[model samples]
Structure formats: structure tokens, C-alpha cells
Target chain A: MSILEFSNVSFSNEGKSILKNLNIRIESRDYISIVGPSGSGKSTFLKLCNNLISPSEGNISFNNKNVSEYNPIELRKEIAYCFQMPHLFGDTVMDNLSFPFKIRNKKVDMDRIKYLFSLFSMDEEFIDEKVLNLSGGEKQRIALMRTLMFTPEVLLLDEVTSALDSENTLIVENIINKLNNEGSTVLWVTHNDEQSIKYANKLLTLENGEIKSLEVLK
Target chain B: MNSGATLSTSSLIIASSLVLISLFFSYYQKLNLEKETIIGVIRAIVQLTIVGYLLNFIFGLKNPFFTTLLLLFMTTNASFNASKRGKGIKNGFLISFIAIGIGAFITLFILVVSGAIKYEPYQIIPIGGMIISNAMVAIGLCYKQLLSNFKNKREEVETKLALGADILPSSIEIIRDAIKTGMLPTIDSMKTLGIVALPGMMTGLILAGTSPIEAVKFQILVTFMMLSTTSIASFLACYLAYKGFFNGRKQLI
Candidate 1:
């Protein structure tokens, strides 16, 4: 079943088109990697999936319902987006992690939080560390973990590991691959060809805000 | 009981010499302020003279209609100026007007009801002007800080939004910061009330021959009034201005 679908969608900003005539169906648990040059609307396309950027024409549907019909707050919870540069809020790592629950008026689950920390190969003690003092890779890892705390149906990643070293990149890649295997649909935008081919079950090549080709990778 | 004598024509002319002295210094230092200083001095003289006559006429009339109209004029001008700080937000003028109005009305209402100030031209007009002007500054700060914070921290806010957080919860920190920025000036001034500087109200009262202790009491009331004015204005402005950052679709504009 298709988890997400976009039909004849075109998004424009300030009289210029960002993504034009995008028609794609993302099946449940599909791992799709998008690759394109810098101005090709790669990030914008991912943003459209989460309804961050609405289309100028046509419609995007999530779960067979028009994306516009869904309340953005509820839609966003189901379709989470992680940016290339992790934007962490609050002082401590725990603060960032607990935000998902905090908004819902629920208490933080320390055991689950510890488990997520371990999943990112970080010790439980790191939760109390100030976000400002964390290294780049640690910040990215924590950001990704915070997004995962809600367990959304779809995960949209925009070059989340671009700034990480090779070792850190491998760790992120492994975690994402694990998430995909566990049945969450993942759409990742990457500039690196190797990472695109390695993780994606299907590789989508985008050019000039349009998908040039879709190829089966696995 | 006022100790200071009224300035005579020659005394006024002697004070006018201070402007000439400033003009001479500007010329000697090669500063371009000679023209600006001359124009500014002339403008101040003319404007103050006009306001003095106007106030005299209005106070003598003692009509509530004229008094209310004057207050409205002052508020309109103040809110218009305050709106400039919120250029990014739509309906900046209306938001400022409402915020400043609420702050001023509440504070002045309390003053009148408590019998601290009578609802007359002299008491209401001056006191209302001070309250409105301070509220205007606070609301302006709130608008400026809120818009800038939302712009700079877009990703941080959107990240929270993506996590199913409502708009209010998502931008809570920035909102808090904006309100803090608005309240900071009054808070700092209150902290150093007499030590750092003697405020205008106290100085004016002292010069008017009010006893020092009585002047102190009025100064304290002014400080408290300003504290109430600033905080209320900032909170109202922040609440109204934040909605402009997000659209109906819940996306940050």
C-alpha cells in the first residue's frame, strides 16, 4: 500500500518554481534516496512530504487522504523531518529528547530514552550534557534520536550526515538502515552517490526540480 | 515654596548661548553637527512653545472631550511609531494600538480608582501620556525581538512543530525571550532607581518644591506604574505578534 502519494504537484516561491510536476508514490516501508545538485529542490521535495511547503498546484496525499486535509500538527507527527544541520533546542540533551513528550503533557521515559541513547551508541550519562558542549556528530545523533522518539510513520532526512566524519556517517547509515528494516518508510536526500546507492531500495535522480529517473537499487 | 526662579528674557537668551557654544565647538572639531544642531535647537524652541500654549488652553477649558481627544492623538502617534518595530508582522499598527491601549487603560484605571490621580486634564493627561509612552516602548521591543527570533530560529521551531508540538509550545522559548527583552529596560531601571540615576518624575517633583520624601513616594509609584505598563504591553504584543509568524496551515511565514 502506498503510504504517501503526490500527483501533478508543483511548488513555486516568489514567482519561481521550486519543484514542478512531481508525481510519485511512496509505498509503505520503502527506502527511497533522492540525489540532485544543490538547486534541484531536493530538500524542498522532502519538505513537501511533511507539508512544510505546500504545492502551488495539484495535491499531496498521505494515507490516501489529501495532505491539506490533515491538521499540520498531527500530520507532522506522523511524518517527521530532520534537517541537514541539526537544530537542537534547550540546554541539555535530555531537554531535546523530552520535548516530544513535553508537548503532549507526558512525562519523560528515562528507560526508553536510555535505550535510544544506546541505539545511537551514546552512554546514558550523555543525556545530562549541555547541547552547546556537544560535538557536531553528537548533536546530529541526538537530533535524529529526538525525531525517532515519536516513531513517525515516515522519516524524511535531508543530508543529515553531510557534516559527519566517515565513522559517524557509518553509524547514522546503520541506524537508518535498521529503521527501514523495521518497517518505517524513509526518504533521504543525499549528495553522495555511494550512500544513495547503498541504503536506498530505490534511487531517485532529481534534476531541475523534476525527477529524471527512478531506478530499483535493491 | 518652589526654590527656582522663572527664567527672565535675558536668562533665556543666556541659555540660548549654550547652543551657540555647541555650534562653535562643532565648527572647530570639523563635525557636521552645526547645521543639525541649529535646526534641532530651533525646532525644540518652536515645538515646546506651541505645546506650552496648547496645554494652557486645554487645561483652562478642562473639557473631558478635548482631553480624551488629546489622549487619543498621543496614543495614535505612539502606536504608529511602535508599529515600525514590527515591520515583518502584518497588521503591526492594529496590534500595537491594542497592546498599548490595554496597558495604558489598565494602569490609568487603577490610578484613578485608587484616587491617586484624579480624572482631570492635568492629572490624567500627563499620567496617561507617561503610561502610554512606556507601554509603547515595551510593545515595540516585543515585536522587534519576536520577529527576529522567529526568523533566526526557524529550524529550531519547525523541528518542534514536526514533533507534533503546537505552535504555542513550539515557539515558547522565543516568545519568552521577546517578552523578557521588552521588560528588561524597566527591570534594570527599577534595580538602579536612585543609585544610577534620578528619574525625571522625581527630579521634576523635587524642582517643584515637593518634599524629598513625598517626591520619593511619587517616584516609587511611577516605577511601579511603569513596571505594570511594560510587562502587560509586552505580554499582549508577544501573544498577538506570534500569530503572524505562522499561517493558517501552521507553517512559519
Candidate 2:
């Protein structure tokens, strides 16, 4: 089933087109990477999917329903977006991890949280430590764990591993690859061609507000 | 006991000197003063003259109705100013009203119930002035900080939303920072109250024939009240103002 689709989508800011006549589709469990040079509208495209910015011209549908008709909050729950720079809140790591569930009025899932912590090789004691004291790698790991806690149907990763070191990058990649394999539709945006080729089941290359090519992974 | 005319002349001279000195400093610092200075001076003259006359009337009227009306006027005006200062914030008026109303009410209640002051017009007026003014500053600062934080950290905020977090907790970091920054000025003033400066309450009491010790005691109360009011106002304002930035659908507007 097609979980996400963008048709004839065009976006403009201050009278300039940032994305023009762009179209794309993602099926269930498809691990797709969007590659582009800097300022190629990659981030903007991802934001459009999440309804952070509405399209100036075009239509987006999720699960075959027009995205414009869905409540933005509901849309966000379906398609989660991760930023290049992870922003963690609260004084303690546990506070950061549990914030999402608490805000939604859902009970905290300790078992799932613990499993995720172990996956990232984070100790249980780190949960009590303040997020302010965590290094960049640790912050990214926590951010990723928090996002996956609710298991959204689609994950929009906006160069989330760009700021991490090689070791942390590998850890994140392995985790995301595992999720993709387990039937999560992933739309990742990155500037690294090598990373795109290594992890992406399909590739969509963008340049100057347009899709240059779309190809299946060999 | 001396000539009223002489005292009035001295007061005018002191006020004029203060205005001139402030203008000179603003000019020397190259502050943006083209229209603001003129407007500020006019506003000062008009507001002070009106307040002077109003205070004189209240001192003699001794009517609770009139005194309560004056309190309402002060709170309304302060709330309006706060709302205006926090432009681009949706439902700002509601937030401002709550912040100013709650802060002023709680402080006034403490003063009256504790018998620290009598339930007279004069007492109510000054206490209301202090609480409302401080709350106005607090709300204004909080709104500014929250908006700027949202602008600069857009990416981070979105990341949290994507992670299955709702808008409130997703923006909690920014809101907390805003509240802290908003209350900073009040906190600093409290820390420097006696060492660096004498606040208006202390100075006014001294000029009105109170002993230095008595004036200091009153100053301490006012300072403490301001701290309490400012903290509450900023916290409430930040929490409420954050709602304006995001729609009910959890999308940033």
C-alpha cells in the first residue's frame, strides 16, 4: 500500500519557488533516501510531508486520504520528522525520553524504553543524568530513541546523523536500518552519497527544487 | 511646613533634570530616538499629570468604589501594554489579563490579609501599581524570548514533534528558557536592591517623613512581592503564550 504520496506539489517562500512541481510516492516499508546538494529544497520537501509548511500548489495524500483534510497534529503522529540537530529537553535523560508519551496522555512504556536504551548501549543510570551534560552523540541517540517510542507509520529523517561521530553514526544507522527492515516506511534526507547508497533501498536525487532522478538500489 | 510654592518649584527642577539627563544618555549611546523620545516625554508628562491629580482625588474621596475602579484601570492598562508589546502572539490579550490579574490579586491579598497594610485606597493603589507594572515587564520579556527561541530552534522543535511528542512538551524547553529570561530582570533588581540602589518605595517613604529603618522595611516587602509576582506572571505567560505559536493541530503558525 502507498503510505505517502505527493502530487504536483509546489512551494514558494517570499515569491520565490523553493520546490516546483515535485512529485513522489512511498510504499509501505520502503526505505527511501533523498539526496541533494545544499539548498536543494530537501529539508523543505520533508517539512511539506509533515505539514510544517503547506504546499503552495499541489496535493499530498496519506493512506489515500488527502493530507490537507487531516488534522496537522494527526498527520504529525503518522509521519515523524527528525532534525539534523537533536534538541533534548528537561533536566534528566528520563525526562526527555518520557516527554512524548506524557504529552499525549499515554502511559510510559518502561519495557520498550529499557529495550531501546539497551539497543543504543546506554546504561540505565544514564536515565537519571541531566540532558544538559550529555555529549552530541548521546543527545542524538536519546532523540532517536524518543522518536521511535511511539512507532509512527512513516519516519522523516532530516540528516539526523549529520552531526554525530563515525561510531555514533554507525549506531544510529544500524538502528534505523533495523526499523526499516521491520516494515517502517522511511524517507531520509541526506547530502552524503555514500550513506545514501549504503542504507537506502531506493534513491531520489534532487537538485534546484526538482527531482533529478529516482532509481532502485542495485 | 515651608512655602508650598518653593517646594513645587524644587520638585519641577528635579524632574526636569532627570528628564534631561536621561535624554543625554540616550543620545550619547546612539539609541534609536527619533520618534520614541518625543513620544516618551509626552507620555510621561500626560500620565504623570493624570496620575498626580487622580492620587490627590483618591486621598480625599476615601470611597472603596472609586479605589477599586482605579485598580481596575491600572490592571487593564498594564495588560493592554503587555499585549501590545507581545505582537505576533495570538490570544496575547487573554494571557496578559490572566498574568496581571492573578499577580496583582495575590499580592494585594497578602498585604490586606496579613495586616501589613490597611485596606485603604492609598495602600491598594501603590501595591497595585507595583504588582501590575512588574507583571507587565515579565509578560513582555517572556513573549519576546519564546518567540525568538521558536524562530532560532525551529528544527529542534520539529524533531521532538516527529518523535511522537505533542506540541506542548516539544516546545517545553523553549518555554522554560523564556520564563527564566523573563524573570531575570526582577531577580537582578532584588539582588541589587539595597547595595546598588534604593527602590522607589523606600525613597518615597523617606521623603514622606518615615525613618530610614521604616523605609527599608517597606522596601523589603515591596521587593519580595515583586519577585513573587514576576515569577508567577512570567511562568503563566510563557505557558499560555506558547499555545499561540502552535495551532490546535500541533502545526507551527
Candidate 3:
């Protein structure tokens, strides 16, 4: 079963088109990597899956139901997204990590957070540490952890590791790749050609707001 | 004691001599403010003269409808000017009008209900003017601050939404911050009321020959009124202004 399907989806802002007549199906557990030029609407394409942006034309369906039919907040929970430059709210790492649970009025799962932190090689003390004092790589890791804390059915990565060092990047890629193998579909957007080929089972190439080519890598 | 003393045209012109000092400074210092200072003084004279007669007429009539109409006009004018400060928010006039109107009306209603103020033109007009104008400033600050904060923290907000968080959870901190910025001036002014400088209400009442104790009482009431008005107005403005930053799809506009 497909987790996400975009059929003839096109989005335009002001007058310029961002994505034009995009057609794609993201099946369950498929690890897809999207590569494109800077302005080729890679981020916009990821946003469409969660309905962060409604298509100006055509339709998007998630789990066989039109995305427009689902409540956006609920839909977003099932399809988590992370951006290129991570933003951590509040003062401490706990604030960012516990937010997903906080919004749901659920208690924070300390064990889960600790395990995820250890997987990312984060120090146990870093959980209580202020986000303001963290390095860029640390902030990015925290952001990724926050997204994975909920364990969504699908994860959207918008060049989330772009600002990280190779070491941190590998940690992130390893975690995301592991999650993908664990039955969570992944739509990873990256500029690193080697990383895309290695992590993605299916590769999508976009140019000028449309898909130029798609290849089955593995 | 010179009780109920009034300024005649001759006395006013004598007072005008003080402004000449400013004109002189503008000339000697080459400040290039000579024309502006002269025009400002003249404009104040003309505007105040017109307002004096208008107030005299309104007071004599003692009609509730007329007083209410004038209050609305003042609120509208204030809202119009305040809305200009909110460049990023759409329909800022409506936002400011609702904020100021609610803050001023609720405060005025409380004062009237408690019999602290007589609902007469002379009592309500001045009190309402202060409340509405202060609320205007508060809302303006809120609108500007909210817009700027949201713009600056766009990534933060978008990141949360992308994480399946709703608008409120995403931007709650920024909302609180904007409200604080909006209320800062009023809070600071309240803190500095007697030590830093005397407020206008107390000074005016004293000049009008009201007892010092009475003047202090009214000043305290006005100060309290301002604090409440600013908080209410800024609160409303923050809620309304934050909406402008997001769309129906919950994306940042």
C-alpha cells in the first residue's frame, strides 16, 4: 500500500509555479531520495505530502484517502517533516524533545529520548542542557530526535543534514536508514549525490519544478 | 489663591514667548528646525483653540449620544494612526479598532458601573480618550512586535508545524514575548510615575485648582486604568496579529 500518492499535483504561489503536475507514489517502507537544483521545489514537494501546502490543481492521497479529506494536524502527525536548518524552541534540549508529547498532553518518554540520544551519541547531560549553548550539529541532531520521537509512519527530510559535519551526517543517515528498514517510509531530500544513492532505494531527480528522471537504485 | 484662573488671549500670547526661545535655538544652532518649530507652535495654538470651543459645546449639551459619538470618533482616529505602525499585518485598522474599542469600553464600563465616574461628557470623554489612546499604542506595539517576531522566528514556527504541532503550541512563546513588548512602555511608565516624572492627569488636575489629594487619587485611577487597558489590548492584538503570519493550510504566509 502506498503511504503517499501525488497525482497531477501542481502548486503556484503569486504567479510562479513551484511544482507542476507532479505524479509520484511513495509506497510503505520505500526509502526515496530527491535531488534537484536549489529552486527546483524539493522542499515544496515534501511539504505537499503533509498538506503544509495545498495543491493548486489535482489531488494528493495518503493511505488511499485524499489528503484534503484528512484533518491537516492529524495528517501531519503520520507524516513528520524536518527542515534544512533545524529550529529548537524553548531554552533546553528537554523542551524541544518533549514538545511532541507536550502538544498531545502526553507525558515525555524518558527512556525513548535517552535511547535516541544515545543512538545519536548525545551525552545524557545534554538532555537538560540549554539549546542556546548547543553547536549547529548538536541542534540538528536534537531536531531529528524530536521528529523521530513520535515514530510517524513516514518521515520527510528536507536537506536536514545539510549543515552537519560528516560525522553528524552519518549518525543522522544511519538513524533515518534504520527507521526506513523498520517499516517507516522515508522521503529524503539531499544535495549530496553519494549520500542520496547510498541511502535511497529509489532516486528522484527534479529540475525546474518538475521531475526530470526517477531511478530504481537498489 | 488664584482659583479657577483662565488664560486670556493676551496671557496666551505672553506664553507664546517661550516658544520663541525654541525658534531662537533653531536659528543660532543652525538646526534647520526654525520653520518646523514655528509651524508646530502655530498648529498647536490653532488646534487647541478649536478643541477648546468644541469641548465647551459638548459639555454644555450633556447628551450621551453626542459624547458616545465623539468617543467613537476618537477611537477611530487613534486606531487609524496606530494601524500604520503594523506594516506586516493585514486589516490592521480593524485589528486595532477592535482591540482598543474593547479595552476602552470595558474599562469605561467598569468605571461607570462602580460610580467612580459619572458617565457625563466631561467625565467620560477625557477618561475614554486616555484609555482608547493608550490601548491604541499598546495594540500598535503588539502588532509590530508580533509581526517582526514571527518573521524572525519563521523557521522555528515552520519547524514545529512540520513536526505536527498546531499553531498555538508552535508560536506560544513568540506570542507571549510580543505581548510583553507591547506592555513594556505602560509598565515602565507606571514604575516611574512619581520619581521620574509626574503624569499629565495629576498635573492637569493640580493646575485646574483641584486639591492635591484629589489629583493624586485621579492619577492613581488613571494609571491603573492604563495598565488594564494596555494588557487587554495587547492580548487581543497578539491573538489576531499571529493569525496573519499563517494561512488556512497553517503555513507561514
Local distance difference test scores for all models: 0.88, 0.83, 0.88
Q: Predicted chain A of model 3: TM-score relative to the true chain A?
A: 0.97
lDDT of each residue in B18-85, candidate 1, tens digit only = 88889999999999999999899989999989988998899899998998898888889888999986
For residue B253, give model 2's deviation from the true position in Å: 3.4
Stretches off by above 4 angstroms in model 2 are A68-71, A89-95, A104-114, A117-142, A160-174, A194-201, B1-50, B91-94, B113-119, B212-217
Candidate 1 per-residue lDDT, tens place, A12-82, comes to: 99999988899999999999999988999998898889987688999999999999999998899889999
If both were scored by DockQ, which would come out higher, candidate 1 or candidate 3? 3
Each prediction's DockQ?
0.72, 0.47, 0.73
lDDT of 3 by residue, A1-218 (tens): 88788899999999999998999888899999999999999999988888888899999999999988887888899999988788888889999999999878899889999999899988889999998899988888888899999889999998888878899889889989899889899999999998999979999999999999889988
Better of 1 and 2 by lDDT: 1
Reference contacts preserved by each model: 0.72, 0.60, 0.74
**Tens digits of lDDT, candidate 3, B20-123:** 89889989999999999888987998998899899999999999999999999998998898889888788888988888888888899898999889889999
DockQ score for model 3: 0.73
**Candidate 2 lDDT, tens digit per residue, B10-98?**
78867777777777887889886736877988898899989889898996899988988888888888989998988988888888888
Docking class of 3: medium
The backbone clash count of each candidate, in order, is: 0, 0, 0
Clashing pairs in 1: none
